[model samples]
Target: MAIIRPARPSDAEELSTVEHAAYANYVDHAGVRPEPMTEDFSPLIGDERVWVAEHEGAVMGLLVLTTRPDHLLLDSIAVSPDAQGMGIGRRLLEFVEEHARAHGLGEVRLYTDEAMTSNIDYYLRRGFVETRRAVDQGRRRVFFTKHLG
Candidate 1:
């Protein structure tokens, strides 16, 4: 069973480790570091924007969310490489939608590298629609949004 909870200060290091391991596969394809690979989780942890998916007390995945006045941003979601193919990513995304609904937000938004076609398809299949495309930090990004009624 996996438990999803708010990230604590002590989980910072482990979160970083998970992030790096999860994103390592994308670095080569992207030809640059993925934003999540370089994000510092310390401040995010303090802000309670980070959540971890733990299995038997071991962190297996994580989701970072930012709440705005009108919607929730799914800033990042990563499942440890060792834990991939086990539906952790899907669970984390579901959690994000639930969290957004609970907060009275009607939508969720996220962005991913344009090169990650698999990820784009994953989100599209889950009901997210591409909102636009733009370049950020020299990387082409595909933005997506899901409206919740």
Candidate 2:
């Protein structure tokens, strides 16, 4: 069974590990680590808006939603490689969408590499539409938005 709930500080290390593994390729390709792939979760998980998906007593995935009154930012979403393809990512995303709506946010924003065609397709299938593209620190990224309102 899998359960989604607010992330606790105790889960920080595991979340950080998962974040690193999930974004390692992107980080290397981009020549920089995205904020989400940082070494510590203190800045994010400590913010009180992040959530995790626990399966069989271990956290398999996580989603961090940062709000700015009018919009929601999917600052990060990651699933353990061992747990990928099991729908953990999808569940975490759904949780984010629901949480955004509950907070009265009109939309959710996120970004992924333009080079990651698979990721783009996955987001599109999940209702996120590309809004724009930009080069951030030498990395080509596509911004996406999913309306929650």
Residues 5-98 of candidate 2 have per-residue lDDT tens digits of 9889899899888888877777666666766776467666677867889999998888887888778898778988889888899888888888
Task: Please write out the lDDT profile of model 1 over residues 22-94, one tens digit for every residue.
Answer: 9888888888889999989999999999999998899999999999999999999999988988888889989
Predicted model with the maximum lDDT? 1
Residue pairs clashing, model 2: none
TM-score, model 1 to reference: 0.97
lDDT of each: 0.94, 0.83
Residue pairs with clashing backbones, model 1 = none
Q: List, in order, the clash count of every candidate structure.
A: 0, 0
Off by over 4 Å in 2: 27-35
Off by over 4 Å in 1: none
